[model samples]
Target chain A: MRRWLALILVFTFALVAPGTNPRAGEGQAAPEFTLRDIDNKPVSLKDMTGKVTLISFWATWCAPCQVEMPHLQKLYDTYKDKGFMLLMISADDARSVSRVKPLIKSKGYSFPVLLDTDTKVVSQYNPNKTLPYSELIGPDLKVLWQHQGYTAGDEVETERRVKAALDALAAATPPAVAPTATP
Target chain B: MPPTPRAALVTAAQALLLGLGVFSSGLAAAGEGEERPEVSVSGQDDLEFRYWRDDRTLPDFPEEDHLFDYWELVNRVNVKLDRGPLQLGVQLDAVGMLGAYYYLNDVRVDEFDLHADGVTFPLPLAYANLDKAWLGYQGDSAQLLVGDGYIAFGRGLALSLVKNTNIDIDSSLRGAHAKVTLGAWDLTAVSGVTNAQQVWQDNPNKQQIRPDHWHMVSGLRIDRYGLGPLNLGAHSVVYSFADRADLDAQPWEGYGRGVDAAITGASVEAFGVAGLDLFAEGDLFLYPGGEVLGVEDNQPGYAVYGSAAAYPGRVALLVEGKHYKDVERVNAVVSRDLYEVAVGPTLEYERVITEDSGAAVNSNDISGVRLRADVAAKPGVLTPSLTLGLFRDRELGGLHFNRAPETIVHPIAGVDWIADSVHVLANAGFRVDKRDDLPGGVSLGADRMAHVDLSLGFPIGSAHGEIGGDLRYFMWGDNLNQQTDFTLLTANAAVHLGHGVSIVGYTDWTDDPLIDSVGNINENLYAAGELQLQPADGMTFKLFYGAYRAGIRCAGGQCRMLPGFDGARLSATINF
Candidate 1:
């Protein structure tokens, strides 16, 4: 009887526990918070309304991050015109600001880079205890998906998610009404 | 409060059963999947049952008598579900260990029972990796997984657990993971916490323990866009430790001041030429108190590594080189993980002459070069493997390839022959340097020593029961004004006698020389045997009786505090 109770307790945790990252198809609003970018400018989550958002938390010295940056830039470039915004929050030290800015320039990346010098945004939003994690937020302010780690196969999936989010937003926006409607 | 023995026994039993159940589940899964051509499991259990007579070595210390017992079971199940699509599956293992105190060696330094010292029953303790599970899916086109897992990037100078899991700490994370690949581009991401074993144990004890040690990681890799010979990968992390107080209180040891964002770095690797591939990576860590630390300290650590493998028909030759700033073990807060640089070069040769009979030969040659300043020198542990290799520095005694201080010269040569179910192996090396690190000053030419070993192994009968034995010897030349000759002979045999029972035994004899810092020899002696039996497939009972002049065990080049036992030991591993 005691063993049965213990097993039941474990099953309950699996079902109700808030996992390391958000699960797909979970109908819940994404946590919102504000953080300052590298330029010491406020990047508010609420302000990025009516557009799909990709928030990536990263550090400068990570090996996998070095491999992932170019593709992220590509994703930003391809869908920037379609109301898609990619916010990269770097957890690097403030001293690294000088180093990171140069790295960005050398790579010729144009995406908006934010600095979480204090790591406040990570704690409030996802509280990710692991690294190389990404989140896709729908324009409706719900967490569409969340995942961790980087591998050779993740690039294709990220692209598909980006395009799908854009399509969903486009469909949600009503077409322009005819001018004769006023008459 | 009184120490009740019954409660401790019950917890131990629970842990044992849970571990067995998990092991059986994995075995059952492996038998079901045909797609998995190779399925295997490795399991180990360590249990110490003893009655304490005293906690000290001599008569001066107080004496206490009590029955103390604990056990740990670790089982890993791996399956290559499909090679064509490259699907890989692994289970982190079910951890079953009980009681407030397991063993002197097994106890976590910080763990403690909150009850009164004399009381034992209903011992308040913490557990890890229980009722935890994870799954991973991998393929050429795409991959997906939802379960607890682990991730590491680069050489682990920044984040590297995808390989080495030597450290007895949080190596696996509890979370959901996924990755997808398209042509030359690949992306991956994971979300999890430090240890899945702890799971929700911190909930009810939230005030005392915060369960919010959570994180999310994502990155991508692109290679040879067909535009140019280029490769790139990047990683990012969003993490938060629910309880930062513990980290905040620790002293800044060059690594960092804060817990969150302690390990954060970036790298850019490239490939060129047919045989040459190169890489360079760096890291940055942000912490509280307005302090920033690099990989080891505030200094950015970088390295360049390359390898060349040339295959002339079926015979192949390969050489790999790694040169990086060394991460100082002590005073990391003040120094970069790597300061002075060292280089390692290894050449390996392998070939197969007869494919049908499975006859093959393999060999490797190794060399290392070090550049260091006087300030980086520190006393470190000694490892026997370094003596076996030919190339080693005499001026530095930190030990091992990664921890050596000052200049080092070391090389290794080895050969292996395999035919059907039979195999033979032998390796020899010589190492020397200018430092007075060894017990003796340069007595032999240029402070160098020699190590050699040989072994032969084969299987018998239709069941492929394995039996093997070998001999190894290490001779230290009186190079650094010191002299000692050490020889170790080990013989091992394993036979499946009948039914579910198997008998295995091994004996080791060693001739060691005791010497002082000046290389003055003090004593020379011999030490020798181990016998174990598995009555059934589930439990392995072992009787280890050995007379050792000295026994030493080390991890990460760090030596553990082990008492020299000249008598006997009884041990067992039981799995359901």
Candidate 2:
């Protein structure tokens, strides 16, 4: 009994220890990780420093995720020129990863996709590991908003959050100087 | 003594609620600015109440017992804890039933005994079980997992350990598993005890019970990826049973001792070559200490499976072949549960093979080939597919039966068309079974079987609802010169009544000539209606009334036979 109690105490201490938990949440700094895209190219979260980023965690087996894909594509098309980036991370395992490229091609979705076969990246962003989960990170590398699960018409709210982050980032940045003094 | 199933369920529910409350409070206390441990809780519940009556003159039970009523509630809770690289998950399933139905009383609690305070319990009408629990750690290129979890290897040809919740089948392994990746090579090792039960005795007056024994299993797999469109892998597993003396006293002593069973296999997969994909696997099974079924000097077993597919433009083609010789059915463990035993690699058209009107397809001692072709007339608008299958028993020295070999052939065609909010699907198939030799040296020739099904769904104009209908017909002729035909028709519609309320109704009619001839009973008719109210996100309430017929329900290569019912059901679901 004493040994059991000691083990429990140690486990509790470890869980509560400082810097032991690395979950990304609203107002918290987003975790950094490298992942490979469908083309087998490595991409990292630190690369997009000046753009509002929308990271969507998805899977082919998730019905809601499938429903939300087209909406994410639309959001990407509408905001790409406005300094916004969208990354779709698939949580499919190694066995089902082969189907990802075909499914995306069949659907004609042009957004960049990253493979999270081992779920290492997904676990850092969304601790619950729920599919159809999304996070909006500001240009400052802080998570501005996060949403779990999806329903019909939920994409409107997501777009609203993304636009809000984009507008905030624009307001914070200094405008470019006009080079008319030389004339 | 251990608590009753009901008491245990109630306690578990209470504890779950309390834990959620405390965790939520902790999160609130930590505030949004501070770093905190991650916790997630989610679950779903299904409640159904059924009242049934037998219409047949020759019923399985007496007339007085023909009419029965029952209610069942199933709850599933998933909890996850994550801190840095360490993660823990616990899934609990609790089912409580109060009914006079015999099927409900036959619930198997063998696997549940592992965590039920180590006390034996009777198969009660109300029971709950802890389904799965696991702890995992993820590092740069390696991982470790311990406890109950699912695992699969190499297209699941030789081994697949998974859970089928819809059919109440759980084959999770309980032990340790590890995986490591080095460059292009990935290796995995698993050592675990099968969390399943085996029936040792059959009581003439009661339901079958499981013995208190566990099976031990260990396996290793190595896979190499990124070989320029070529991948190779190999896997091997060993299974060992408990002592013979412990099993001899059991009722299944004649079934041979379960000591020393092993399977090893190699697989090859290739893609990105001329728009074609190929996969092939071969496995060999060894039984060191005699045969599994007590046969004298039984030989080893082997199986080979291969498939090839190509998709170019608007057309796709696929061909598959499989051969098995004296290979016994494989499962995560030997299960006493009637619905869970005999699990193997999931195959295409599994539902048709298992639920056919005639004799079901044999999983072992057989060789077969299948071909499928799909053509898209309008890309996503209209697509049609054709399928063909031919199978015959392999030469195994009459291990299965003394009768001559028989061959079965199946040909099927299907089409799907979707435009805007309208969708339609139709399928037609024919099956023929021919025997090489009949009893008394008489040739029975071939028996014909045919079936067709059509379904359509369309939106209801501007009402934001949908309406659907389905029609199905089947005909079969047995080798004994008996013919049977069955037809089913159903129509359903769902309309949003506005204000977060919806109403759905469905009606069904079935005509079975065989059943009618046996009991001179009337045709069966069933109807149901449901009213749903969604007051908030992730929450729903449904009130339903229906009359249903006994049928087989299948999902993920697992099937369960459900009893007929006429009932009213109320259910609520909430996730947070």
Candidate 3:
């Protein structure tokens, strides 16, 4: 038991100290990837720079993902104006990618939805390729936390984390000074 | 005398160092006039340990026979170093096992060994090795990578070297990959041999793992983007399989004309054109070796896939179709059992994939179409969706349980409602596959299936509770090769108290004869419990104890029969 504790400690310290790539959880720097959003624009982890970003990997054929989508949209609405961004990437390959845009448009989701037709992006984060996987990254692009598979009340916890990240970002940012009136 | 494991490792280390020295020097010389910024190093480690038992092992043997207590530990670490436009990455894996067993020749056994029959040798199953290493560079207009990496060309119809976790597939190319962006055209090229992962994180290993056969592969893609809503692209992949008995003694030994196959494809994507998004792709599969698995004519195969979507105001509609003839044969000669080389979209619902429905996902001769429509019934409060899919399969070989041709039709409807803290989501579908007459004007009954999946989350005082269930009923056709009709159901409920705490209960019941496990509570029912804790922002843990049955699971156009487990599991995922 002591050995197990020591092993866990070492792994945590090593990754927390100077790690850069994402294991999709705390102390990890989200991995790098490139994808095309629904509007045919390039999107990547770099877009989250200087902002709190939530990245979700889902598919059109996954039922749990659909259940989570409505909640994600609600979360985005709650935090979008407060230094927040949500990127919902589809792992639908070429078969069901076309439905991604229509579904978003119909639901009126404002977050950017990227297309990972080859599933390369999801592999970098969760090699097991669990559906509805998500990661919350801070302004520095370091992952704050991650969640796998979705439950109905899972978003309640997610909302708390998102708010904390946003508050942290807002506290760190210095308010803009008004222009001095000329004498 | 054969060298010891330590000696072998030392020699391998020396060889790797030599290769690294030469490789870095070559790249350094090419970048003589370039700037080298401060190099930053970062990486991540994922470790999973599973200790469980099958409970099927009898009490007649020592240590509870073969399928008793087993544990396996697997860890994969990826380290990346970056400086300006240059990057280098190395990934390694460490695997250890004890008392692990898998079915071999209908008998539960550990990794194969010719020296021992009765005694278990768990030491031979432990291994640690270097998985892959790669170096990459990115400029303002060009990108190049020279070691092991993933690549996909044109929706993966020609070459897709990415991971498919649904089937436990993780592979890369062991050569060079390059991409260049011109003013109006983007060109990408890759040439390498197959580099398959030796250990998997999600699947049970049954055999002694070894290196890949090193099938040579090369691909090229050219795309012209920003062409005023009309983008065009073309790509090609060439493969030369290595089918021999040398156990990779001499890789790249077969590149003759008779051992190669080429798949070339073209695609066009139009966005925002007349308020519609359209995409169409066509591919030609050319095999000069005449080694295609189930094709008798020795002629080339072709595939056509297209989709169109229109999102107007509050309503969205999408239609997609695919005609694939012998497209699945591309996987036959290239690491057939390890990974798939070309994977197109399968328009079937993935969660409800059964043996009968999964067969049509990769049929050599199949044509299908699917149409989906979503309407915003109440702005931000409610949305409903309807989908209809139809397909016909002409081929009666490989994995199909029917003897005659069949036509399949599926229709599904779903709705999403969100009101304050109470949310509801539900979906229901009906599917039927009608087989043609069996040569004597006699009817070969149809297979009919219906399923429902629903989830509800509501507030409970200051806390909240959620309930979800999936129901499926399958009626078998009058086919001699299939099993009897069956029904399957799963229900789960979770109660979330405050302060990062939750408890979940799970139950599964099935009468599917094809399934291989007896339930934990009875002959056809299973029950389990789980507790989740997130005491801090960076740490999360889950503890589960119970039993679950096994069945065939399909995803991303691939199918595999996953095994059942009955035991306790504790797992932790930490961000740091």
Candidate 4:
């Protein structure tokens, strides 16, 4: 077993030796997963391509997450029309997953809410399993910003990131022609 | 909430790369990030130091009788690197077990074996190992992984194969997993042997860790969506077991050992039909071994579950039903530990599960129905909900304390309200599980449980600081014949100072003799305090003291009886 571990370590180093820049890599593309939304409709990461999307990992039993959700709701309502998407993925598991949709409906949150009954998705992005974890991804599937926990007003920074991504999205595109006056 | 940009700028494939680069630079400096960094590294470190001790209050013994003093430190670090589509990750664990020595672990070992508590020490008191490593690739719609992975099939009735962190059980398949999404169809398959985590995060450490058993588990799942309002899926799982649990053998060396059992299932989901969302699944458990898991029925088991949900205006309602006949026997012979491959969601409220209620959670021949409704009394400001669950346990043996058939009726009411800076969340429930159904339909015995839990939040002085606390009370009426009734209560107060600093004081009182926990305050009480400091985002440090009680905890259809903890600990979690 020790020898086998040594072989594993040798391969590990060999894998890491080819890296060009370590610090340059902060954000990786989000793993693609398909899950049923609150309404039993399938929602996939591929559905959110070409958009600046903010993914929030939350649970019904998490008090801080409950307090932070209203702020996310405001962000969703603010940016829903701006080609900005918000995926409120619940990590409630099977125990409290039933409360996810009710909680979201009570807040009138129109953002897409996905149920991660097995906690697979949250384990991927936030290995620490921190509640109310948020990650901002640009149109290119690269994560632009990530934040953990919430302090009521932390959405200010999240909103700023969303604005920058949207502005940059608009800046990099060719301006559309204005419609001519009708006769 | 202020107004945001009217146009979200929805879709623009042409600017995908340029927009990502410009946005990356606009927020962060140049060279820090780009549309897709060639090599992105992200990792997490969780380290804990514990000073384990205990004292006894027996009349025959003196003060601090059977005193056990041990100091242990366990650290786990996992790092993931993604270069373009290629991803590699590994988790390393280091443990140091010091102090008190132990005799025979099995007690039958007349031979004296000096051990540090449960582990025998030889070379050193500290050891480190490469816990987990995996290599994978993530493309546009396809994902290929090898080394270690997690998979859950349809509602998990047939095959779940996922992590259960609550009980400190993270069993992964030490093999390969592949998935591809083509248009509206998604296909996923996995093949490997079960690899349970060696160093437990919550439980004590053990030496000479190896794979639970060389159980060759393989499965394939396929789903097709967008068939109008109907979506369909099906899955099949095959399991092969080893004849022996040998620790010295290599993984999968015993595999070509004959197939033991298989599970095949199908599921259907429908949405946006007459203001309702419906889902149903049916699975057949094939026990090819004739007599499997000590059951000589030689008959196949089956499980059927269905749920319907509706959101009408400000109200949300859901109704679920399940009938499982000998469905828990699959994979029962694969592992001598807590590694279960097939688990389906249960109707019982897992958070409020007790010793008596846990029986129904793992009952093989059980059928039940649950109805829940939530009303937004005043939208987000105030909401109230209620849930009622009913179950019939026909054949109870494993994990069942009751000897006769039983009926369970559980009703819970909850409310969530926020009044200007003050928020209150509370829930209270009483469950009755009556057994020995007489010929006239009357129960001769019953096990009852009642619980109440709540959390209150208060805004502090004008500085935006916050103060809150949580309280939980449980009373159990056990009818295990020789069991004793018990009550458990825990209360805590939290002070959240702005800028990611918080302090919490926890108090627990329990008289459950079944729980072998040493209290910090008195024989029947425990106390603890934790100070959490988040210097910056994505990093947290926690310093804790005192002890806490233990009990049976169930999550995601899986239940385990966790041991009580008594120690002083400090931990840190950093993700970057």
Top candidate by DockQ: 3
State each model's TM-score restricted to chain B.
0.52, 0.76, 0.88, 0.85
Candidate order by decreasing TM-score? 3, 4, 2, 1
| lDDT (Cα, 0-100) at B178 in candidate 4 | 91
Superposed on the true interface residues, model 4 gives a C-alpha RMSD in angstroms of 5.8
Sorted by DockQ, highest first, which candidate order results? 3, 4, 2, 1
TM-score to true structure, per model: 0.44, 0.70, 0.85, 0.83
Which is the leading candidate under lDDT?
Answer: 3
Winner of 2 and 4 under DockQ = 4
**What are the per-model DockQ values?**
0.01, 0.08, 0.34, 0.22
lDDT for B282 (candidate 1): 50
Compared with the true structure, the alpha-carbon lDDT of candidate 2 equals 0.57
Per residue, candidate 1 scores C-alpha lDDT tens digits across A32-70 of 454545333446666678999888876654434544666
Question: Which one is best on TM-score?
Answer: 3
Model 4 chain B TM at: 0.85
Q: After superposition, how far is residue B387 of candidate 3 from its true place, in Å?
A: 1.0
Rank list by lDDT: 3, 4, 2, 1
lDDT of 2 by residue, B476-559 (tens): 434443445666566677775444577888776777543321111224777788897765443456787875555555544455
* Pairs of residues at least 3 apart in sequence or in different chains that clash in candidate 4: A81-B8, A82-B7, A82-B8, A82-B9, A83-B8
lDDT digits (tens) for residues B1-576 of candidate 1: 221346434554564455445433433454554554332222122332211121223243224422232322223222212222222233322222233243345544312333223222231332222223433333334555444454444333333322112112223445556655566555666555444222221111111222222232232322222225445555544333333333222111212323433334454443344633334445443332222222234343333334333323222233334343332211122112111011112111101011100100000112332211111011111101111212222212222221122233445554444333344445455444433333454222333445454545355563224434334343433322244555544455555443334455555455544321110121232232445554432234556544333333222111212222333445443321
Docking class of 2: incorrect
Cα error, residue B440 of model 2, in Å, equals 7.3
Give per-residue CA lDDT, model 4, range B1-576, as digits (tens). Answer: 211112111222223334334333432443544554455667767777777765633354456544356666677777776555566677776666555443344332211122223233232445555556677766667878777777787788888767677677777787888989898898998898877776677776644343345567899989998898888999999877654444334456646556667889999888768987788899998878646465576578999998888889888888889999988887577535666778887888787887667768878899999998888888777888898999998876566777678888999998887654567778888888877765776545677777887877776773234444333344433344445566778778777776777888887788777676767789889889899887655567799998887777777777777777787887876666
How far residue B100's Cα lies from its native spot in candidate 4, in Å, is 4.4
Error of 3 at B289 (Å): 1.4
Write one digit per residue (lDDT tens) for candidate 2, span A72-181.
88899999999999999987644345446655654556789998764545644543355677778888666676666654455777898889888888899899888788
Clashes per model (N, Cα, C within 3 A) = 86, 0, 5, 5
